[model samples]
Target chain A: MFLALVSGNPWLESLARLAIIAVLVPVTVIILTWVERKVIGRLQMRLGPMRVGPYGTLQGVADTIKLLTKEDVRPQTADRWVFELAPFVIVVPVFMAVVAIPFTADLFIQNLTLGVFYFVAVSGLSIVGFVMAGWGSDNKYALLGGVRAAAQLISYEIPLVMAIVAVAMLSQSLNLAVIVGAQEDTPNIAFQSLAFLIFAIAGLAELYRQPFDIPVAESEVVGGPFVEYSGIRWSMFQLGEFVNLVLISILGSLIFLGGWQWPWSVFDESVPVVAQIAMMAVKTAAFILFFMWMRASLPRLRIDQMMSFCWQLLLPFALLQIIINGLVLVYDWPNEILIPLSGAGAAGAVYLTYRAARATGVRYQPGYQTVGSVL
Target chain B: MTYEEVIFYVVAVPTVVGAIGVVTARNVVHSALFLILSLLSVAGIFILLSAEFLAIVQVLIYGGAVTILVLFAMMLTRVRDMPAALDGPQRPFAALAAGAFMVVSIFSMVSTEWPGDTNKINVISIQQIGNDLFTTWAVPFEVASLVLMVALLGAIVLARGEEGE
Candidate 1:
């Protein structure tokens, strides 16, 4: 149906594809918002959104309507142009990043040869939007949140990109389909588990989800960069975030979980598009659920702690994974060799994190007796 | 005009306007935002030229990291406290230096006889670039990285000095 309609005109075809994404993304965000509330509620031992549609399925819809109708407010002191444009800066890049993401082998808006690189680069553009929102709002809290968001996002991006590079090296391709196809026999996860770990951690930080969500910590900077946003403007920020959540999940599944190929590859040539999509959905869903679960279970980290963790722990481990992969590829070693080496790195990361967590309690420094005494 | 020409103008207009805005904007943050605009549009030009890798790198480093660093400094230093921040007594000398630099760059750019097809976009694959970097240009690549490492260390030292003092 789509192919026939979009036949002949590249312009029309792109418009049609974009339209589908534009419509589909919001619907997904709505469903996800409801799911997140329900999941988090379950984790906390309570009913979530029970008053809306069946089991609160319509809660997201209700919230959407509310957000759309809410009056957009602008503070008099705010930088008018910057404040107005900030949300777009934050939102548009995320939607653009969605363009190259493949659901099935064939289903994508545009599959660039540089799909992984394009996604990372485009997503990085959103950091400027956070800063814009922070500075434009003219609110101290908003400014602080914006700064935190920028720092956290920028720092975590290194590890995330490094992890993705490791996978790209193993696959010897940057195309999403090529990467997934390369994993037909054994998923990249088996060889690059350490990269997977780094990707997950860095992905969580990128999403500004819990534990790493110091930028938007309610107790501190009170909603971070979006503190001043309301109505449809604010909804745009929320949309960017959930879309980002889906993007990261899909990318993670594609790079590390073997995308649509893994368990279903047994059928190989006979696997239907529906089946392929279903497999992709399952992995993406698992990632989304894991993100939500982490949000519910973990305490938010202090900004200092989060930054230190990314730089001191995650960055080093990610680089090590890349180095190890390079060695294996250069030496023409068996792919199986990656397992033990990557596993050792993964173990080392976990142990270091464990030690760091244990050692982070309040301790007295020698020269700071007065400050230490209070603690 | 061709589609490529159309696309080039679309991006090129913003690149020029953004460059102008960076120097002319009253607010320092506005200048940084304009700088991002300029950088991003240049990335768009890279896409027009079919250098997707270089385009993305431009967006990632210039549009993303460098501009954010500038904003961070502006915010941390409380740039708003000073009125007419850019209107310093050194403005004349700065403008003269900038004008001279721009003239030299444009002269060099115009004078150079560029190689490659003028009509067809030369598509360079990532693999080709990687092979060249590791094989033909390996020493220069390593030297560039070494320079960056030294700069990184220097930044750390500068940042660390306040505590020591």
Candidate 2:
């Protein structure tokens, strides 16, 4: 239908695709905002927004209206161009990642051969936006938050990329559609559970959600790099973040949960397009819900602990998974062997976390401490 | 001009402007941001050439990691106090060195016997690159990794400082 409307003009086709994405993303963000509020409210045993629309369905719309009408404030001391451009810098890369992401095998704006790599590469560019917002604000809290964000992001990016690399290795392809197709019989999660765990944890850090949201820790930095933003500008930042949450969930589903592919290949034939999309949506929703649950339940980690977790525990295990994968692939070991090996690695990771927590005595104590003592 | 040529100019103009901005921007943070713009535009050029792997790496490392490191360092230090840091007594020497380097690079670029047609995009697969890196270029790959490992350790040591201190 889209191709028919656009005829054969490549430029028009591209523009139409982008136009659809532009509309789809904001609507998704609005729905997600409402869903997050309600989910978190349920987790906290409180009623969320109940006054906007039926079951508060229109709360996001109301908030959007408010934000759009609110004054766009910029501090007199703020750098004009940097302050203005920071939101676009942060938001555009996320939407760019969406272009390469496949919903169903055939559903994507553009399916690049290096889809995973392109997503990772483009997403990393947002760190610059964080720093820009922080510095441009000329506020100390914003500056601190921005720097913390950059540090946390770049640090965790390693484990995240390594986990993705492990999956790419398992699938022996970087293309998203091909990766999903490779998991037609067994999802990569079956053998690469450890990588999935790393991906989830690192993804949590990447999104700066709870337990890893030290950059924007409300009690500390007070919204971090976005402290100075207001009105529509602030909405743009929130839009980017929620959109990123959706993107990460989608990517996770595609790579690990056998996106658009039924479990056990029950059909033994091509699944209908609708069923495939439903499968993708269900998996992505599961990830999004899991993230929301974590946000509600988990306490934010200290900066030191967060950094150490990524570097010490997550990074090593990620590398170990890759190495084990290499050994199995090179030696042509039976695929079943990976189940036990990865399971053991996951167990080791859990045990190490338990030991680390016990050694640090992280219960009910909050104060600055040496990194070595915590580690 | 062809569509590819049009896109090339669109990207290349920013690349050149960004390079100039990096040197001319009075504020250091602005300079760093301009450096990112320049790096990103170069990545765009790489995409045009169909070296998608190199382009992604360029964006990932240079545009993302390296510049963020610079920005992080800037935030940690007194960046505002050094507005005129780029201007100093060594200007003449710096200019001479930059000029000489530019001439050498341009000469090398023009003289090189390039492979393949200028108009066609040759797409290379990541698997082939990985295979060649591990097989034919194994030593160089290992050496590169060794150098990176050494640098990583050196950074840790420098950051840690004297143990007792």
Candidate 3:
């Protein structure tokens, strides 16, 4: 169906898609920025951006205009071309990743057989932009931030991909649409809850939201990689981050929340495509709110702790989920049996982690035993 | 020009230019960036050939992982963003050998008659590759992974050194 439309003029069709993506991503980023600020503000007992257009809806627009009007600055020691190129590099892959995301049954830009792989691979490319921004800035703070960002991204990516691999295993397909289809009988969260949890947590770290946001800790490195960026360039990085937040939320919804499918098979086939799209948007919005809630509530983690969490805890759980999934698939276990077994496995893993943490005195700190005190 | 040829040149030009830039760039960071561009354009070529899986893997492994690791190592060594001359004493001999290899490769390419499949290219899906890797080539695949594991252990031991180990 899509091939027929593009067969008339492939270049024109591609151009149209590119234009839509270029406009859509920035617009989504704008609204998402406002949404985050408002949600986070309310969480902290404040009215967020109330003075701008009705209920601060136009705040993102105003901010964009203001950023556009502001003077762009570059450090004297900064790498000229790379510093300028970094923001576009950051933004483009995010839009590229969106190409494989099935917005609705027929609403996606493109649906490759390797949709999940494409999204994961393209999303990983954005770290280069952060690194470039950091290194190009030529400031020690920015450089440190860039290195930290790269390190954190590389570390968290393993668990993120592993969780996605689990989903692929359950669905038996890498295509997002097919994954959604497989959930018609039941959402993946019913059985792959462990994988869902790991994906969400790793995704949060990948996005560098609070707790995992050591790279951009304002008190520490001062905006991390984008410290030296000013005006439009800085805004681009901000927009890219917001876009990423939306993308991760959408992915979580599509992979675990059954996408546009109605839960329990209620009106699963009878529902109109528009309403299905709306359902996807609503599910994605729930995740966005959850992300904001996490940001408001969680304290920043030490970099070492963050690294250990990904490698030690998340990696093992993700690997275990995969093994359980492999066993279920190989043994041809019924869902009734497999779901509870996997759930028990997940609970056991959590309990063991808690016990290990307690043994190490990490969960509850011991009373002060002075050994090489400043005194 | 035919569409495929046009697309080929479009991707190939940058790839060649990037390769040249990687060799000639003064800054090590710039060289690394050029290498990324070269790899990405190669990925683009893969896409043009309808090998989407391979293209993404190229982007993931080479463009994303290897280039970033190279840049990371360069930064840790405190050489990044510095204006260091890349010219070495072996430049002339290296160029001579490289030029000879290029000539030989071009001669071989022109001499060879490539087997052409006139049929429509069927995209080999990721599932097929995964199946073949685990079933048909399982032993080789496991061996490759074991090699990687050994290399990883070696790096860790080397980094830890005498007292730490």
Candidate 4:
């Protein structure tokens, strides 16, 4: 990093940086997931598979070995190359996202001129992997699920971008760490809460959890896109998902709550590295818990309902939030109008959204009639 | 070779080969996959150029989103309907167009000198672009946003397919 900065050669520096993070990011994701599972297990009042080795420290290692040694299989009718390549599609984009995410002010690896736009933009790549997996698997369920995920991601991405744009408008920055730092210094959640809400909601939708996970609704699609995957190949997809959870948690802390830095400028540079990691981990843990909580709480949406919710409700709300945020940042709005307007907007949006779905909510009771059945 | 030349070759070669594969490959999936390789190589070039933001955006948007959307469409429509992969067919004037494009691009590259010394990439933040977007280029920014709004609506409409009553 020092050499790249001093010598003015970007290529060598980027290569050097990528090599370091390629190992670093994946390692962090693995260890953190083990921790997440342990926490969740305790939350669920279960022993959480603690029999591996000493507080189940080797639980993940044991599971990994089992998955690794498992048999590899392909469906008889499946396309060979694309089936093999599906997991790579998912892995590469997540790896690429690391470039835009920064740990500290000076500790960033890939500093894009476009900043967070790079982060927002590159997110679309994973859809390819999912979609390809479904179609390549030669299974109806997989293909349908992939198509569903594709729609879900693209639709939710609008709100996600809009929410981020609101932040960029307010702070006037696109760098991930810079966004977090701005929040840490200014502490403007009072005004930015709307943006935060929009971001979180949209973000969860993007992650395809709970209400948004229709594509992988086990009962709906029978294991969805990964139905045909097996052995180490399936493990790659699983690992990618775990990495995604970590990345999204890091992002939540980044864009909404302050990332690694604490409020009030409390810490000095003299603090130890583990302490920094611990602080970041605490913030990240809160986010992961929120994610798992949402997963446990919400019921999955039907495809049309999910699609309409995003495009009609979340999209407009996100647009309005960005506009209001832009106005405040550009020419400070009177608190009189600003505060209540945001609250009313959020409440009204939610109420209308819920009401809109009320009639649609009546499900086909297992024996009830489903829509689009060719008699 | 100098460091710049080495970087140039590293980025440029893959991009060119990938571009060739994207066009020449008969299979639509192969074409799409090759397009990803092409875009990824361009992203590598952006990294080489020290435009980290641009490189990441290339990877995220072009690599992540666009590629995924294409795959989605491919999945929804056809999986095994890839007769082109088995039998290559010639496109009308494809050879001539490709030749012309390559010549023109190389000529442009050779003709244009470096954008002043061709080798300084400051690791600036998103703040700089934001400032530029809102201040010096605010008019263009608003106009561009309006254009994006139209594009967004157009995409939604196109995706939905017009079977309006």
Candidate 5:
């Protein structure tokens, strides 16, 4: 029956892609967990994992096995069905997002015409899952965390989408491969640097990482919406978060860095597919490491502070970046002019925002002793 | 069955089921979730029709944003705590009205001609849609933005209450 339903080429191809992605993402997530711990550990001067495998490289695998075997506990007050469903909702979207990401020049699952748009639109749905998890738990802490996460997601999404819009406009196409192709002369980082910054920063906030990690703030909400989840369910949420981190890095590389394209054609089209994949890996790793650095270094923002940062600071800058991009597009500015102009504009915007905030008695500085003193 | 028919049946069944569940569910959260399911299946139908852009927009807006917003509002209020509040006194009348509307709409849809070539489908690109929005529908688009701005300002005013003074 199945054989009759699907014929030779497309079916096999699609199935192969699906199987690869299904296996690849979870394995990638496991590796990311290890990388994040080790990198952050080094930054903080600690040994991350030393018992599981070589330098604790297999810690993630051990953790997974442990999670699988542990008791799956549910809160007595929790809405059982919604609680069970939320993890799937969170995880599925993260996995599906990989469908649109161009792994290399030619190696993508489905090259939809509206690839970037589809990726953004699909990725946005994870917030709904987070909210569901939070609400379903029926705990005050979980509810607060869920609501905070939802609000944060909604706020950060605007700047993230706008930044992508700048990239889409410049590329004159929404397809990820086409966007990569358009950067043959120079990557978007040279021209749409501000958009890249907004996208990356907002992307981090969207991922709910450090400095914007209020949603799952351990000191406050006790892991937020996932507080009630245990064992496999908790693992699902953890896997989703890590997958999202990788997805964001891959997206950043594809949109801003010349994806799978070595600078100055150190290796051109004649180069093997292996090299192209390696280049992509290198670029994506750079982003992942950068995110880890930020996580290790930055302090978490207060919820109010985070909200204000998005609405007041990032939103305006994102809008201004769009206007500047539109102006450049209208005048048909060459890369030579656009590059320096946008770079300076980005630097000036950052400085001006700092100056404006200072004038308004808003401190850029975090109070090192205040948090402990207040506690 | 053909591929299209198979897909249509698969999507349509859940869509109808989800729509029914939306009104019938006792829990408001469950109803909101049902609405999301209905919206998602509708997006699936849009994909079958090859309206990819419309399908994604449906998922992104209705499934992601609107459903979450509704759920958020429910969470914020005391509504979730009172499951009975989701039900109303006018259930029979509402059901009757909905049934009548659905019957009439389906009858009309089946009976009347759509007044276009049913076979020669136009799969429009996102670029064309953007161009048309800016050039052909420019006034209407700007007017929509203005309306949204007015609503936003009204929201701010209402939120401030008498404190703005």
Candidate 6:
């Protein structure tokens, strides 16, 4: 059983999974252009791109071919290795999440001992790549974007961690699979509903969509860290950005939604693998659309406003949820009772926090919000 | 060495080289990078030790976050050229002392008896950790929150305040 394998050298097993992910991430990146166009087409009430082959699918491939054939240009004043390496830096964690994601009942790439913890910890790595890309490019806009990104990622990352920890408190473990299994064991949606909600909101921010996309504030920073990049290199950065979005959406599905686990076994036999893959892909696609929808709908939050939301609104709610989760688990409370109670408590906490912030009108800067916004 | 040992040795070579580079690299940025390499190698070693949590945290925290922070500090400060060679007069003696100390420690560890054979039995499940964390290590868990609070303060001070300079 997985229990045994994970109990065994889970670290080694997870490393192997991560290695495979390194290979798969690029392929997934390539396919995502097609997926994005298809989804956006339907969203915009258009048939989407129906040229350059069947369903316009070959469009992404054609684009890739063009990028490959294009010249690799660098600014005369740029950090060469960091410039070239920035794409991989962004792409690396795109795959690291796969290690914790359980596709099938037992098909997690790497079931780390601390899946939730690792997810929280390692997800921040992408910020470095962002900063590196900015500084390495030696462009002012790139530098500003990089700083904003580092601020945004680190600031939002706190709420994200707090949200994940709420789930961990409910599950009483840091493992991602354990969290999912814990959900399955109960009416997971009911008990951890608050945590799930916080996670979704925070996850969206982490993905740099909508309100939190100020880091990539193209209007202000001029395409951010990737301003100076061109041709294939530019394409690599662009491709990686789109892929990271998909990857983050997939992560939301795996963590907040029950990854690849369907309660009703509609397709019980014969085509289990295909069914599972379909379900996962469909769920991931749904979340990806959600990302796009938010991007289209929500206006970007001011840097200070975004910081306040994460620090004031999200973090407190998440911490309180964690406490309530812990109490529920410790007291052996039933879901029917705790579900509404947790929901009320979460809402109450949010209302109180907002009221307090409004009363104070203490405008918080993103850099200052991290520690100062304790409730 | 058997095949497994050989594999471990080969895997460890990068770690060893990187660790040395972390200490001795001329450029601060290069040193920071070498330190990342060393940290990643340590994560690999943790995998070898069957410590998945430790390994992932090693990568997630050290590789991802801390390395970025270091790089951020570098960029914010804008230290392009490294310091001039600052070899001390007693450098060789210090190296010898450190080497001897490491040898003695290794010798003692080799001679000493260990309780659990990490290679033989692996029981590092989330359940097991949960059972113990809430039971015996509960206090430590609470203390970690305080540490994190302090870290928050420290990061703010270092990143923003003039004291950081």
The candidates' DockQ values read 0.68, 0.64, 0.45, 0.44, 0.48, 0.40
Docking outcome class, model 6 = acceptable
lDDT for model 4, please: 0.74
Query: What C-alpha lDDT, on a 0 to 100 scale, does residue B95 get in candidate 6?
Result: 90
| After superposition, candidate 3 runs with Cα above 4 Å error | A1-10, A348-375, B80-85, B96-100, B107-113, B116-119, B162-165
**Residues A228-308 of candidate 4: C-alpha lDDT, one tens digit per residue:** 998898888877777777777777777767666776667755435565566677887888888877776677876877777
TM-score of each: 0.96, 0.95, 0.92, 0.81, 0.93, 0.79
- Please give the ranking of all candidate structures by TM-score, highest first, separated by commas: 1, 2, 5, 3, 4, 6
Supply the global lDDT for candidate 3.
0.87
Sorted by DockQ (best first), the order is: 1, 2, 5, 3, 4, 6
Counting clashing residue pairs in each candidate, in order, gives 0, 0, 0, 12, 0, 0
Q: Output candidate 3 Cα RMSD.
A: 4.1
Fraction of true contacts reproduced, model 3? 0.51
Off by over 4 Å in 1: A1-5, A262-264, A360-362, A366-375, B114-117
Which candidate tops lDDT?
2
Q: Where does candidate 4 chain A have its weakest 10-residue lDDT segment? A: A366-375
What digit string (tens of lDDT, one per residue) describes model 1 on residues A1-375?
768878678899889989999999999999999999999999999998899878988899999999999999999999999999999999999999999899998888998899999999999999999999999999999999999999999999999999999999999999999999899888999999999999999999999999888888889999988888899999999999999999999999999999988484568476788888999999999999999999999888877678778878898899999999989998999999999999999999988888877774675464422221111
Best by DockQ: 1
**Stretch of 10 with least lDDT, candidate 2 chain A:** A365-374
CA lDDT, every model vs. true structure: 0.91, 0.92, 0.87, 0.74, 0.87, 0.73
Model 5 sits at a Cα RMSD from the real structure of 4.4
Candidate scoring better on DockQ of 2 and 3? 2
Q: CAPRI verdict on model 2? A: medium
